[model samples]
Target: MLRLKSLGIVSLICLVAACENSGANYQPVIDGPVGPNYDIDLAQCQSLAARQGAFDSTTGASAGTGALAAGGTTAVLNNKGTNVRDAAIVGAVAGIAAGAVQQQQNKAAIVRNCMRSRGYNVVG
Candidate 1:
């Protein structure tokens, strides 16, 4: 039994050592730019760009309309010699919100591109 135990211990040590050194001599195949086994479609990028453009245009127009309305209200308040600050504040808030939306849309486009580069099908 003692001899068998010694032999088992020796075998375990050899196995551990072999595993440790096995990976040292391994060389990975490196592909540049177009990686191995990765496929990306250019149409995905085009679609993303188009969607982003549409979102920007729509949001921008809405924000402009909102600002115009606020300006009109401010003008009426000024003519009546009442508080016009609130109208200006509301206009600023609406403009900021629209800007934030546009920023988010731009970020989404970047994320879509990244996902496509990572071999994912992005729809939007």
Candidate 2:
């Protein structure tokens, strides 16, 4: 049982990390004009995207917290055979999904805002 609990915790951490690190790739467009300065603007947008991704890493905090709560619950109900495994699997999946969704949302918003700030009308 102890080994199983350890495995479940490791699994949960991996899932949450994967979800938080996920992001969208978007190319910025120039709506107005930048002919000569296009390269500079593009580089700036790329930097902004990287910063945004770093800033958005916190999106998975909720997922991690949820996983911790689930772990606690599993520890409590771990007396029966297979119950801990089943609960941990379900909890990890749900938390990962939630975190992934939030991460994607943050990535898109960042791209859109960054492009817009650069005088580009970004389209999905």
Best candidate according to TM-score: 2
Segments in model 2 whose C-alpha atoms lie over 4 Å from true places = 1-24, 29-34, 53-61, 64-81
Question: Per-residue lDDT of 1-124 in model 2, one digit per residue for the tens?
Answer: 6676577668756765565434435455545555676566656655555554322455456556665677669878675536755565556556655655666567656766876776666655
- Candidate 1 TM-score versus the reference: 0.39
Cα error, residue 73 of model 2, in Å, equals 11
Candidate 1: deviation at residue 85, Å? Answer: 2.6
Estimate the TM-score of every prediction. 0.39, 0.51
| Sliding window of 10 residues with minimal summed lDDT for model 2 | 50-59
Superposed on all Cα atoms, model 1 deviates from the true structure by an RMSD in Å of 26.0
The regions of model 1 sitting more than 4 angstroms off are 1-68
